[model samples]
Target chain A: MTTATAPAVDSVEKPGARERAKRPGTGVGRPGFAWAAPAAVFFGLFALVPLALVVVLSFTRWNGLGSPEFAGLENWSKLLDDPVMVKSLWLSLLLTVLGVLVQTPISILLGVWAAGHQRNRAVLSAIYFVPLLLSITAVSVLWRAVLDPNFGVPSQAKWLFGDGNLFGVQASALGVLVFVSTWQFTPLHTLLYQGAARAIPQVLYQAAQIDGAGRYRQFFHITLPQLRNTIITSTILMVVGGLTTFDTVLILTQGGPGTDTTNSAYYMYQKAFKSFDFGMASAIALLLVLVASLVSLVMVRLSGYDKMRSTMEGV
Target chain B: MALSLAACGGSAASSDGGSDTIHVLVYGDATNKVEKQLVDTFNKTSKVKAVLDTIPGADYQSKLQTVISGKQAPDLFFNWGGGSIKPYVDAGLLMPLDDFIAKNPDLKSNFLPSVFNTAVVDGKPYGVPMRGTQPVLLFSNKKALQKAGVTAPRTWAELLTTVKTLKAKGVTPIALGGGDKWPTQMWFQYIYDRVAGPELFQKAVDGDKQVWASEDSKKALGMLKELIDAGAFGTNYDSVKFTDGGSPALLATGKAAFELMGSWEYSTLQDAYPDFVKSDLGYGTFPTVEGGKGDPDNLAGNTNNFYSVLKSTEHPEAVAEFLKLMYSDQFVKDQLSIGNLPTTTNTPKFLDGSANPAYSTFQYDLVKKAPAFQLSWDQAFPPAATTTLHQAIQQFFNGQMGTDAFIAAMQNLPAA
Candidate 1:
C-alpha cells in the first residue's frame, strides 16, 4: 500500500498534473462566467458598440442630424487627398514619438534618482503628481497665461533679459508649446517609473555591486531589464495620450495662427461639429484609432506580455 | 425594464406637454433677464406656463442641434434663421408656422415683411423673427477722433482720410477684430455690397456670381490691405477672442478710432461700461463706396434671432401658442426695453422708448426704409462655404496667404 501511494504521489509530481489542469473545464479552467458577464457587458456597451458604430460610419456619410448614407470607401478615399487631416496625423505621430523617445528617458532617470531617497519620496511623488491632478482645462489655461506675450513668463523673461516680448519668434513659440506639454506630463511618467524602479529587487543590485559593478552599471544590467514591462506600458500610455491631445491645444491655440498647432482630435472636432461634416470627422477618428492600435500592437509583440505577466505573478 | 421605461415615459410626457408650462430656449445670459420677464408675465396671466432655457451662446448651436435631432427639442427654441435654419428645416425638424401665421393676424401685422421673409424658406415659414439687427457704426475714443480731426467718415474717401489721420497720430485708425473672423468678413461683405450693389450681392448669394473673385471683392481686399498697412488692427489681433478683441478692449480703451461691428456690440458695451447706451454710444452704417451699387443706407443685416417649433410635436398648437406668447405685447415690450430691437412693425407703445438709440437709427433707416436686404454673408452662404470663409479670413488676416489666394480658396469651397 505504501509503495502504491508513493507511485501515485510521483505521478502527481510529474508533468501529467500540469497537463490535466490545462485540459478544458478542469479545476483551473474557466471560472463561473457570472464574474465575467458584467465586465463583458460593460466592455460591449462602452467600448465595442461605439467602436463598431465608428467603423460602420467610416464607410458612410452622416451630417450628425440626418440618417447616414452608405458611401463605401469614399471617406477613406477622400482622406488620401485631405492635406489638413494628413498634416494633423503627422503632427500626432511626431508628438507620440517625442513623448516616448524624448520624454520617457528623462522621466525614468529622474524617477530612479527620486526613488533612492526614501525620506523625501512621498513629498517628491506628490510634487511630480501635481500636474496629473490638475484638470486638462486648468493646466491649459495656466500654460496659456504663462505663455502670453504681454503678461506671461516669456514676456517677463525678455524684460528681465532686456527687450520687448520674446514670444513672437516661431522657434520660441514652438519651444514654449513643447515645454508646457512635457512639463505637464513628465511628473505623471515619473510617478509610473518611480513605482517600477522601487519594485526591482535589492538582491540583484547587491550582487551586481559586490561584483564591482558601479551604480549606473547595476541599474543598466539588472534594474532596467526588470522594469522592461513597466517602461513599455508607460511609454504606450504616454504615446496614446500625446496622440489624442486636444483640450490643451484647443484652449491655448484654438488651432489658430493659420493652423500651426492643429492636432488630429481638434481637426476631427473642427470638421464634424464646427463645419458639420460628420462623415469626414468619422474618417479622421477611424484613422487615428488604426494608427494607435498598430503602435500598441507592435509594442505588445516586442515586449512579450506573457513573460511580463509571469514576472508580475512571481512578485 | 418595461416598468422603469413606462415610468420614465409618463413622467417625461407630463413634464413636457402639461398645460401651464411652455419651454423656450433663449440664446445667452444677457438675454435671460428680458426672456424671464416675458416668461413670468405670460405664466402669470395665463394657465399656460412659459419657461426660459438660457444656454451660453458658445454651446447654443450645437446643443440646439442635438436637442432638435433627439426626443426632446424644447417646445420652442431660439434659432438664428436663414442658412442656419435651412439644414434643420430641410430635415423636416421644424414645424412650418405658416398656418399659425395665417391664423394670428396680430403676429403677421406686427412683424416687418423683410424680417418675416427670412423665416420663410421653400415657401414655408418655420420660425418667426424676434429681433432685427443690422450693422451699426461704432467709433472708439472721442479723444482719438478729435486728435485725428475727423468727425465720422460718411463716405469711402472720408474713411480713407480719417484712417490716414488716425494713423498719423500713431493710433490704430480702425479697430477691426480680425481675430473674430466674422467681423472682418462683415467688413468685406459690406464693402462688396457697396461696390457691387444689392442686385449683384443677391446674385452672389444665389451662386450666380463668385463674389470672392469679383472686382468688388478685389477692391474690398485692397481696402483690407490698406487698413492692414495703416495698422488698423490691435496687436496680436488673430489671437483675440471675439468678445474680448477690438470692441470691448481696444474700442472701450480708446486705443482705436472706429469700428463697424453689429448692433449686438452695443449690448456688449452696455455690459462692459454702465451708462454706455444712455450717453456714450453712437451709430452709423458702413460708409458708402465712391462708385459702388450699395447705398450707405442699404442694410446688410437680417433677423439675428428666431424661435422655431419642432415638427415632431404632438402639440403643434402649443408650440405656436408659445411663439405667440413671445410676440405678445408684454413680451415684445420687455425684450425691446432690454437692448433687443423687436421685430414688431410698431413696437407696442408700452415698450421702453429708450431703444438702443444707435441701433434705432439703423433700424429706422434699414428695416423701415431700405429697398432690399443683403443677408449677412455667414447667414446667406451654405454651412461648408461659410466655414471656409471664416478660416480664409483668419488666414488672410494672419498674413499666412495673400488675398487672391484667400478668395481663390473660398471659390473652391464645397458648395451644397
Candidate 2:
C-alpha cells in the first residue's frame, strides 16, 4: 500500500529498460523501423535470396553452362553414396574439434597474459596480431614453404614433417593444415577475448581481492564465470570458421595426396568448379550449413547463453 | 551496379540481333595481346565490330561457364574444341558450322582433319580451329642424358634403361608435375594409346564400355605402376607443380632429367633458360611400349584452341568472315610469330617465319607423319569427367590406387 501510493505521482520509463528485443511490441514506441529497413532489405537481397537460390539449385542438375535439368531427388540421394563427400564432412568436423580444443584455450591464456602485464599489452598484442594481418593465401603459401621437405624446417630438422612433408603425406597434411589455420587465426580470437575481458569492471576484481581471494581463486570465481559468454561466442565462431576452411587447404594441399585433407567447403567447391555439378555442390553446402547452424545452436543452449543474456538484461 | 545489369539485359542480343558489337571472349594470358591485335585487324575492315573480353587465366573456364549461361555470352569465343564445346553442342546453344563451312569450304579443308574434327561432335562442325596445335613431347636435358651416358629413348625398354641409368647417377629420372594432375595424365594418355591404340579410346568415345574395362587399359595402368615403383619420378613428385613453374625449375636447375610436356615447353624453356634451350633442351616423341599394337608414330595432345560461334549471334555472315581469318595467311603468320605452330594447311610454308622455326618444323613434322593423333583424354571425354580422370591418373601415379581402380574410375566417367 505504501509503494502504490508513491508510484502514481510520476510514471516515466527509464532508457535501456525498453528491451523490445526480449518481448517484442511491449516497449515504449517512438520512431518507426525506417532506420533498420535498409539493412533488412540488403540482408534479404544479398544473403537470404542467394541462400534460397542455392536450395533451389540443389534440386536440379546444373552444369552452370546450360539450362539446369530438374532431377527430382537424384542429387540429394547421391550424397549418401559419395564416400569422398562423407569423408570431407568428417574431416571438417575433426578440424573444428581440434580448432576449438586448441585455439580457445590459447586465446584465453593470451587474454589473461595481456591483462596482468598492462604495460607490455600493446607490444604483446602487436606480436599476436601479426598473423591476422596476413591474407589466407599468403599464410598458406608461407606455411607451405615452412613445411616443404626440400628447404624448410622439415628439411633441416627431419622430425617435424620429415616423417612426411605436409602436403605430400596423408598423416601430416591434415595436422599441418590445422596448425597453419590456428597459427593464422589465433590472434583474432585472442583480441576478442582481450576486448571481452577489458569490459569487466575493475571494482569486481578489487572486491574479490579485498575478500583475500588469491589470483587463482579470483580467476576461478570471477574471471572464468565473467568470461563464460565470451568463451561461448568465441567457440561458436571458431567452430563455424573451421567448418568452411577452404583457402588454406586449397593453396596448401589442393585437397590432395588423395582426398586426405578435403574438408566440407572445399569438397563443395570441388563438386561445383572441378566437377561442374552445381546440384551436388549445393546439396553438400546446404548439409554443411545445417550442421554448422545446429552445432552453434546446441553449444549456445548448453552454455545458457540466452538465459544469461535475459537475466543480465532484466537488471 | 543495377545500371550495368540493365545494360547487360538490354544487350542480351548484344551478339544476336540489335547490336553491331559482336562480343568475343578469350582466356586472359600473354596471348590476349595477339587476340586483341587480331580483333583490331578484323574490326578495321568489317562493319561488325568484334569486342574482345579476356577473363583471367585461373578463372577462365568457370567464367566461360557463367557467360555462356548468362546474358553476356560471346558471339565468338576461344576454347579447347573437344569436351569444352561438347556440353554447348548438346544444348544446341552453338551454331553448327556446316552451313558456314558450306559457304567457306576452307574452314573444314584448311585445318588438320583430326584437329578440326575435335570440334565436330556427332558428325557436325561447331567451331573453327584458331590457335596452333600443342602435341605433348618428352623433353630432356641433353647434359643430364649425356652425363648419364644415355640417349633419348624410342621404346619402352630404352625408357626403363634411361630411368635406371639416370637414377644410378643420382638424378630424378622423370620431372613429373604430379601436383598438377594433367602432367601425370600425359604418361597415362601416351601409355594407353601406345598399348591399346587409339581405337580403344575411339570405341570408348563411341560408347563401348568394354574398351575402358579392357585388358589393354589394365596393362597400360600396370606399366604406369611399374614406372612409379621404379622411382622414376623420385619421392616428392606430388609436391611439384608444372603451372607454378616448380617442375620446370627443377629441370632448369638440373635436379631432374626429363619432363614429359607439351610443345609449349620450347617457349617455356625460351622464357626460363634461353641459353640452356640452345645447349641442353632437347625433345622427342613419347617412347613406344613393347609389343604394343598402337602405331609408334601416333601422337597425343590438344589439337589446338578453336573459335566457336554461338547460335545467338546477330551477324552469322560477319562471324563466318572472322572464322575464315583463322585459316588466312595473315593469321598463320601472326600465330607463327608468337611461337605457335598453326594447324592451318598453310602452316608448313609459314614454319620458316616462326619465332622458333626449328622447333616449329619439328613439331609440324611430328604431327604431319603421325599415323593417328589421339586427342587428350581430358579433352576427349565429357567436361564432367575431367576431374575424375585427372584424379585417377594422379592416384595411379602416386600408387594411392592401382590399375583396377584407375580403370574403374575411367569407366565411371560421363560417356562421350
Candidate 3:
C-alpha cells in the first residue's frame, strides 16, 4: 500500500509544482508574505513593541507619575542587590519544578485510564475537569476560603490540617501554590495525554499481549515511549505557565506571610502596581522574559523536540 | 516610537484641559453615589460644569498615578492624603489649596483639625477632607467578652489580664487578620503610637531612620512581644484574613474576643452579621499603655479620604466650589446616611440622622477630641515602601524576623 501511494503522491505534487511555476502570479496553493502580514503586525504591535519599551524602561527611573528619566543601569544594579528578588526567583523555580513533578504522573495515569472505552471513566473525567472551568481568580478565592484556619475546612479537620496555616508558613504556602496550579491545570494536560494515548497504535499492544507481556509491562514499554513528544509538549507548557503565575499568588496569599510566597511574577506585579516602581518592575519583567525563553529553549533542545522526529516512523 | 508616544500623551493632556468642564475623579465604591450627587449640585449653578469619573477602588491609586500628569488628569481627584499624595506633590502635579483656602477658609476650618491635617504636605494644604475618618478602634464581640469573663481592656495591664482570661476560657483573645499584612501593621501603628507617642513614627517617616532603633521603639516592641508570648492572637492568625471575612467570622461566632479594626468594621459586620453588630459589637479607643510618652487620646488609621486639586485645572474657582460641598450640611448627612462618619464640625448637627446614630456619635466625639490622629504607617510612607513595611510587619508578628531585623527593614523603607 505504501509503495503504490508513494508514486501517486509524487505525481500529484509534481504537476502542482509545475503548474505553479508556469503561472507564478496565480499563486494557487501557495501563500505569499502578505498572507502573514496581519499576524506579523499584531505580534509586533502587542509583543515586540512593548518588549522593546520595557527594555528601555529597565534602564530608567519612573514611578508612573512623570516621564521616565534615564538612570543608566540603576534599576538592574538595585534588582541584583535585592534579597527578595533573588528569593522570588528561587520560589518561581521551585513552584515550576514541583508542578511538573507532581502534575506529570497524575495526568499521565488519568489520561491513559480515561482513554479506555468505559462509561465510569468518562464520568469521573468530566468531574475532574471542573477545576479547569473556573478562572484562576475564582479558584484562588475558593481555595483561600476553604483553607481558612478558623472558619474553613481546617477547623473541622484539625488532625489533618494542623491549624490550616497553609498560607502562613513559607513551605506550606509554596506547597499550596503548587497544589492549586496542579489541580487547576492537570485536566488540560490530561486531555493532551488522552489524545496521545488513544493515537498509540493498538497493534503494538496486541503484539505485546500475544508475546505474554503483562499490562504493567505493556504500559511501561509501549504507552510511555509512545507519548514522549506529548510529554515534552506538556512539560514545556507547564514550565512557562508555572514561571508566569501571578493571579493565584496575588489572590491567595498576596505574597505573604512576610514575602514567604513571593514568586518572581508576583514580585514584579507588586513592584509595578502596588509599589508603583515602574522602572524596577520593567527590569524584573525583562529578566522574567529572558529566563522563561532560556528555560524553554534549553528544554526543547534537551528533549530534541525541535527535531520533530515522529515516534511512529518505523510503525 | 518613544517620541511618538510622548507626542500622543502631550496631545491627549492638552485636549483634556481644553474643555470648560472640571473633571472630578474619585475612587469608585458605594460612596460614589454621594460624590455624583455633589457634582450634580455643583453643576446646578456653575457655568463651568463638573464631571465625575471613577476608577474602581483597588485600581484607583495606580490609575491616578498613570493619568495625573497627562491629559487624562482629573481637575480634582480623591486621595487618602499623607504619603498617598506625596509623590504627586513632589512631581508638582497637585495644586496647594492655600490659595483656595485663603479665599474660602471653610475648607480648612469646617473639617476636624486632625482629619484636615492629614492632607497637608510640606507646610501647605494639598487636599480637602471629603470622606469620613476611619480611626482604628478595639472592636469586640460583647458575647465573646462575656463568655471569657472579661470586659474590653482599658489599660495595657488590663489587656494582658483579659488575654490570659480569654485564653484560659479556650477562646482566642484577639482575632487578627495577619494574612492581609496591613492588619498586622495596624497593631504596630497603635502600639508604637501608645508607647512612643506619634513623634517616633513622625520622625521615622520624616527621614529619622534612627527612630526605629530608639528606646521607645524597643519598649513598644517588648510590649507587643509580651502580648504575642501570651498568645493573644492565637497560633493561626497568620492564616486568617479580614477581607475574606475570616477573622470577622471568628469574632462573630465567639471563637475570639476582640479585633483591632478600622471604623469600617462596623459597616462590614453590619453587612455580614447584622444581629452581631446590633447586640454584640463593642468598640473603644485602644488601651492606654502605662507610663508611656504618647497621649492616651492619640488615634491611628486612615484619617479620611481627601479631594486634591490638580495644579493644571482650568477652573480652580469651580473646583473650589466643588470642595466647599465636602463640608456642607448636605454632604455630612449624605456621608452619615451611608454609615460614614464625616469629620465636618456640622457632622455633629446631623448625628441624629446617621445610619447608626450612637456609633457615629461615638466616632465623632473620639475623633473630635483626639490630640493626635496618626495615619496608617503604610499610608504615611510612600507607596514604594509599603511592600517592605508590610513584609517586615508580618515577619515580626509571625516570629520569622527578629526585632533587629524588623527595625532594619523599617529603616530601609523609602522616605515619605
By TM-score: ranked, best first: 3, 2, 1
lDDT of 2 at B333: 91
lDDT by residue (B1-416, candidate 1, tens digit) is 12322333331223344445656776786667877776776666666666667677877765665555654456777776777788887787887876887888665666777677776777777777765455444545565576667788788778777887787787767666554567777776677777867776555555664776777778777877776666666445554444443345556656567777777777677777655445545556678778876776666765557887777665566566656765677666666677677767556354336465545544554666666566777777656566567767777765777988887776776543
Give the per-residue lDDT of model 2 (tens digit) for A1-315: 334333322223444453543576444244346656788899988788878888988999988765678998898898989888889889999989988898988999898677665787788789879999999999888777665555457657766445333566676777788888889989988888888778766877899899999999988877777788888889888988999899988888888877777889988988888778999999999999898988888887898886766213312
lDDT tens digits by residue: candidate 3, B171-238: 99999999888888888999999898999999998999999999999999989989998999998988
Residue A166 C-alpha lDDT in model 2: 53
- Taking the candidates one at a time, how many backbone clashes does each contain? 4, 2, 1
* Candidate 2: clashing pairs of residues: B15-B314, B16-B314
lDDT of 3 by residue, A1-315 (tens): 344345435545675755655665543443446667889999998889889999999998988767889999999999999999999998888889999999999999999988999878888989989999999899999889988888788889999889788888888888888888888999999999999999999999999999999999999999999999999999999999999988889998889888888999999999998899989999999989888989999998999999978999778
Error of 3 at B329 (Å): 1.0
> For candidate 1, what is the DockQ-based docking class?
acceptable
State model 1's lDDT.
0.67
Model 2 chain B poorest 10 in a row by lDDT: B4-13
Deviation from truth (RMSD, Å), model 2: 5.2
- Scored on chain A only, each candidate's TM-score is 0.81, 0.85, 0.91
Candidate 2 lDDT over residue span B1-416, tens digit each? 22333353452224455878888888788777778888899999999898887777777776676567556788988888777888888777898888987877887899878788778888888878888899999998888888889999998988988898899999889887777778888887899899988899888866787787788888887887788888899887777778767777667767788999988888988898888888888888999888998999999988888888888888889998888788888888988998888888889888889998888999998887877888888888877777777777777777778777767777787886
